[model samples]
Target: MENQRGKGLSFARRIYRPRIIGLGIGAISVFATLYPLDLPNWTWALLVFNGLVWPHLAYQLSTRSAFPYQAERRNLLYDSLMGGFWTATMQFNPLPAVTILSMMAMNNVAAGGLRLFIRGSLSQFAGVLLSWALFGASFNTQITALQIYACLPMLTLYPLAVGIVCYRLAIKLSEHKRALSALSRTDSLTGLLNHGSWKDLLHIKFHKCQQRQMEASIALIDIDHFKAINDTYGHIIGDTVLRHLSSELRRNLRHDDLAGRYGGDEFCVILPRMSQSQALDVMERLRQIFSQYRHPQVPELKVSLSIGLAAFSPDFQDPSSWLNAADKALYLAKNGGRNQTANNAGKSHFEQTQMA
Candidate 1:
């Protein structure tokens, strides 16, 4: 269910923002009609500021030239100036200025929250609400009772709608982004994470072990004679074998366990908070599971796996070293015989093979 939902969110990211743009245009049109060209000088200036100048300035200061986080900050500056100008205009002609400012706030919240959704940040709405509140407070501070009472309701209503729309949009975008990220990091054919995920996971685990003195073991598992399975039984059946193991490994392992496709017919597992002996037991269980199963197409799908595991230690300062030691153990397993498990607690007295 979770994976299906993630896929659906991925589909939504491609469609949501462009749809919001149409809504934005309609909102802007309404704002323009409410504050026509007949307004007083102060009101005219405020309309131009909020309707055109602010967005243009925000684009100039932001967009392509600055980093995302930096651009978000610059947006606040532009919004503040626009909101201030709009608030002063509201005292002169309270109705139109309020509507224009509301439109601006709504647009900001929409765009900022959408961008934030993609980038995995949540603080973008701060500018929208803050600017609205600043304008509202400034109006209340300077105006007499009649104007204040007339404008305050419009002030609250517009910002509230903007906030709500933006809030919902932000959540949708966030979910979509997360799902896309997950998809990018995982293998499409099998459920396991991909090569990129493996590299990233290794780096993260190594850093954790360095900082906290945690024990970690990694298993490199390869289906023995996988090429023969593909050549003899056809690639379709071979793919089925790989898919089946991926499901089995994911089901068998603990929640903290991570399995990734290292390459063709090869998979790697990172087991946090586990000793070398424990890793071997897990590998042995995998061997038994594959042995017990048979493929209908091949009939004799007696495929065996070779596993090489290594415990992360101080000498394993780099990710390459851990992989090297694990690969060496793997080589020994393949050399001695197929269907065996090997592990190194630290650097073995023998040699460790360097991996490409």
Candidate 2:
């Protein structure tokens, strides 16, 4: 209910300025038609109120209502009714009447689509009938030059106001779309790329490396004894440990490098334009920094990483082959000792670097 009310308030605000512009301009068109007829004092007063006061009144009514959206819709119907009443008061002067009615129809359709258009048209018809009963039915189809000039502002300015509102709405929607797309591509826990997005980026990186013969490397990292940590402490502490490693990776890696959470306690990184030795140094520093971190909540907790490094080689067939080479190096790092970095370089034998 709160969300609905918020949306309703927003809807009312969006309509407020356009309503003011349309009605202020519309009054001129109606006045040109009614001037020759010499309507009563009360009718002139009503016209003044409608032209100058009603827009603000409608905004206040909708904004303060419990159901603001519904209130705004009611206000739109009132506008349609007033438009019909004015058209009849002019005895259906062709140019001014058609301009007023057409603009009201445009507003109804824009505000609430076909459903509101239908309802507003019915309200307008009722107003026409009320005017006929009070003033007697009469028709004056002639349109003077003065009436045409008066209608001009309503025709031009009202649509311009509506267009500006629509343009702003489109821009906001586009920004929201971009934000949602970013959220979908990101991991909730670590703020890194999720598994699928990371893999997609890896494929692009692999192709770039293969085509240009560029020196780049990939790393697969595991939180050492993560399951044991979770078992001893809790999943919460384990999550903290994972987030710590991700923070360390973000801080240590270059801006161009890509890191992603590769499911569970494992993470993957892409080091573009870097040799195997450079990649190893970067990963080793990250491992050392992370190993020394002490969780404030669990002061007894200590963490370490086992990382695997693989440089892009021409002998690799696909992105999967490159990934598998890194996986093999990770395995060697894990088997040799838990806290170290190892390089496979598309070879059977691994070159392992154990952290002291």
Candidate 3:
């Protein structure tokens, strides 16, 4: 409901300036047609109010109403009705009458689409009937040079204003689309790539390695006994530990490296242009740094990581094979003991940074 109201308020603001410009210029066109008719003093006064004062009045009515969008639609209907009244008052002078009615139709269509356009047309017809009953109907087929000149400004300027508003709306919609796309690709908890996005990138990386024979490695990291940490401390502290690991990964990895949360209690990384030994050294450093992390709220809490490394090999059949190798290494690291790094090359090392 709040969002709908906000959109309504925005609609009111967007219509405000265009109404002012249209009515102000339209008054000039009406004045040109009425000048030769010798209309009564009250008729001239009403014209002045419609052309000069009504725009501001309409804006106030729409903006201050509880249902601003509905109020603005009512205001548009009023504009169309007034347009018909003036057209009849001018005895249906061709150029100014067409200009007034056509512009009001355009406004109704732009603001509320086809439904409002149909309603506004009915309002205009009612206005025409009322004007004819009051002052009688007459037609003025001949148009003066001055009247044509007066209608020119409305014909050109009003459409230009509407176009500018539409262009700005398109730009805002495009920006919102991009922001939504980014949110879809990112992990909510850690701001890393989500599992699906990470796997997509992995396939791309695998193809590049196959084609160029590039040196690269993939790692699977498990928080040692993460379920135990959550069971003892709560999910909040478990989340904190996960964020800490992700922060350390961002700090240690190269700019081109890709990292993602691989699901509960596990993270994955792709290290391009690095060999198996280099990947191992990087993982070992990360393990050491992370083991030192202490939760501020829970001073006694400590964390450790078990990381597995797998370098790209020509023998691998596909991206899944490469990922499976890293998974196997992770299994070995967990079995050898927690707080260690293991490689698919059949080597494992234990680092007693924190005692269980």
Candidate 4:
């Protein structure tokens, strides 16, 4: 309920400024038309209330309602009705009547598209009939010079207010789109790139290497005995360990490097422009540092990494072949011992002695 109220309040505020600008200018036009004829004291008072007080009241009505959007739509219909009442009361004066009706129609369309525009027209017809019954259906065809000048402010400023509202809405929509795109690409647990996005990046990187004949490598890293850790320390601590590892990877890797969670207990990295030997050194260092990571929550628990490195090869027909080589090397590293770095250069496997 609180969240709904907040949204209501926000919606009210977004509509408030435009309503003020539009109605304030409209009030001037209506007052000019009303001033020429001698209307009753209560009628003038009603005009004042509509122009000066109604905008704020309508905003409050919408914000305080259970469904703000619906309340605001009703308010817009009320605005259209008022426009009609004033038009009829002015005796259909050419300038003010047209100006008022056009502005109200614009507001209706902006508020709820064609459907609300038609609904507002019906309300306006009702107001016209009410005015005819009350005031005996008068007509004043003449549009005095003062009234034309009065109508100018509504013609100019109301459109500007509507434009500003539309621009602000566009900006908010763009921001939402960007935020959603980032969320889709990111891993929920570790905040790394998820498996599919990482794979997409790997494909791009493979193409880049093939085109430029540049040296690059990919590493598949696994947390050794991760299931045992989760079973012993609980999944919560295991999650903490994963988060810590991702943090370390973020801290240690270069800005250009890409790291991703390639599913449970395994992460992937792309090392561009690095030779096989350089990739080995980097992976070895990462393994050493990760093996030394001590969780604050469980200080006695020790964590280690088993990583597999595979340099890019022209013999590979596709990105998956390159990835498969890294996966095989990762298997070897896991099989050799719990903590080590194993390398696969072309078809040959290196000894799993790269350990700290």
Candidate 5:
């Protein structure tokens, strides 16, 4: 299901909390190794500067710094290389902290490789393995089976632990984005697709119809004397009327049909696999349903929809032209009598309406 996949993807992109945990471990090591042993003045100074550089730069580059993909990659690669040089400077230090720091550098490199190569799962795994092997071999002259076992525990679990945390966060962030997107494309009052999305829907549906040679119809529905409702009651009541109509429209429409709030008190429907006459019958059903949408708060509230049908056939040039034909019939319905439907297949007025 889309919902479940979307949830999984969300988890993939969250903040890696282990980075902070690792940094905290580093901080603890600083006091245990540096303050107690008090290494050379130069070593202390260099360590302090390197400490500031790694966290600050990592936070800024990952969160704030935006660059083209290739360029960002090159920068990360540079950091990974410099990391080695930074660690090698303290090889002569008496403290084993530098030794542990070097192992941490392997971590930094593995983490960097993961960040750089999104699709290259093989490359990421290999890089992590190599980093771990080098880290083990560096501490001990020869990498024995015991050393390899010690490295395996962290190497196998670190990425997984951090990855799960991030994956969970990404889902929540994505939901926020999806909700905002939905609001933008929706009419708040009607809770239906607004006019903004209509053009795109029309094109997409047109392609579908053309491929399958599926009969499709467009209906323009305008609520008659809707202005009177607003005038007699309040705009608040008028808004409630609109929302009520929208709910019924959504319930009545087929899954494939699209209902949109075209503008103030005007609505439209796009019904697939329906000819003009069949569409008219559907509109009448909708009309009969609309006539009953009175409220206990406003008993006088009454509205009727005038719909026009246009079927896409060989005569119609395209979906846009077909919609225009529907609009022409809508005009006729409005002028002739309110709450009626007209079919405008192969009619000259449809072409004229398109030109206008």
Candidate 6:
């Protein structure tokens, strides 16, 4: 029911403003033709009611309907009916009749595309037949100067209103598309890039370093004893610890650094334009920062990180090979001790900076 109302409001807003503008202009267009014929008093009153009051009444009817979009669509068909009636009553005067029918068609198309256009056209035909039966059918091709002036507002202003509405809707759709793209690439738990997005970035970074002959490093990080933490304090507390590590990474890492949740209890990072030594320093800082975090929910609890560092190399065949090096280094860190940073290159001793 709420959803229906939301749709109704959206339909109402789209139709209301334009109807007000179009009908106000339409009134002028129709009156110019009718005035010369010296329409009967009741006929004149009906024309004024339709031109001035019907727009507002139609808006109210559609908005209050259970299905607003469908209601607005019906209103558009009625507009076509009224347009045909006016055209026939004016004896098919070329300028005013054309303006009325064309504007009605435009409204129907805007509301429901080609299907509505056909349906509304049929409704207009029915209205023309009814008017012919009641008031006699005729044609007046001549359009006076006053009628032409009245037609100008409908021709120019209504199209502008339609264009403005369409432009604003396009902008809103573009923004929604961008937001959905970001959400797809991001992890809901840690607010970091998800596994697939991270891997794609790694592939891009790998080729970049190869072409530019520039230095960069990759690190794979694990939360030491993560399963044990979950066992001791439940998965909720374990999640808190993971979030803490992610927050620390955001605070310590450079703006250009890319970090992502690789999988359960593990994260990956790419440090661009940085050597092995700089990478190790950054990882070491991250490990220390994570170890110092004491959860407010469990004040006695502590967490630590085990990190592996690997530099981009000409010898590596692909991004997977570089990732393998970091994984191997991470294995060494866990084996050497639960909480330490390890570098896979050359004879660099495993940094045994463990925290209790």
TM-scores vs. true structure, each candidate: 0.59, 0.93, 0.90, 0.93, 0.60, 0.92
Question: What are the C-alpha RMSDs, in order, of all predicted structures?
Answer: 12.8, 2.4, 3.3, 2.5, 11.3, 2.8
Candidate 5, pairs of clashing residues:
10-170, 10-171, 11-166, 11-167, 11-168, 12-167, 14-166
Candidate 4, clashing residue pairs?
A: none
lDDT per residue (tens digit) for residues 1-356 in model 3: 77877888899999988898899999999999999886779998998898889989988898888888999889888888888899998899989999999999998888889999999999999889878987899999999999999999999999998888888878998999999988999999999999999999999999999999999999999999999999999999999999999999999999889999999999999999999988988999999999999999999987899988899998999999999999999998989887889889867854423421
**What lDDT tens digits, residue by residue, belong to model 4 across residues 1-356?**
77877776776787888988888889999888889788889888888888889999999899878888778888888888888898899999998898889888987887778999999999998889888888879999988889989999999999999989988988998999999998999999999999999999999999999999999999999999999999999999999999988998898888899999999999999999998888888878888888888878788999889888899999989999999999998888888765877778422234433332
Off by over 4 Å in 1: 1-152, 345-356
Whole-structure CA lDDT of model 5:
0.61
Residue-level lDDT of model 5, residues 1-356, one tens digit each, is 55644443332223224544444344333333334332558655655554445545554454433332333344344443433433333222323333344444454444455444332333333443554444332332333343344334344454565566556657867998999999998888888899978767987888888888888888888888888878888899888878887888888889878999989988888888887667766777888898887788877667777777788776666778878888888888788766766668433333445666
- Scored by CA lDDT, what does every candidate get? 0.65, 0.91, 0.91, 0.88, 0.61, 0.87
Q: For residue 89, what is the lDDT in candidate 3?
A: 86
Q: Which pairs clash in the backbone of model 2?
A: none
Rate residue 332 of model 3 by lDDT.
88
Give the per-residue Cα lDDT of candidate 3 at 241.
Answer: 96
Model 5 misses residue 247 by how many Å? Answer: 0.8
Residues 1-356 of candidate 2: C-alpha lDDT, one tens digit per residue:
99999999989999999999999999999988899896689998999999999999999999999999999999999999999899898999999988999999998998999999999999999889888988988999788999999999999999999999889989999999999999999899999989999999999999999899999999999999999999999999888888888888899999999999999999999999999988888988898899899988888988888998999999999999999999998998889777888888532223432232
lDDT of 3 at 41: 95
Off by over 4 Å in 3: 349-356
Scored by TM-score, the top model is 2
Error of 3 at 94 (Å): 2.5
For residue 83, what is the lDDT in candidate 6?
81
* Model 4 CA lDDT for position 304: 89
- Could you tally the backbone clashes for each prediction? 0, 0, 0, 0, 7, 0
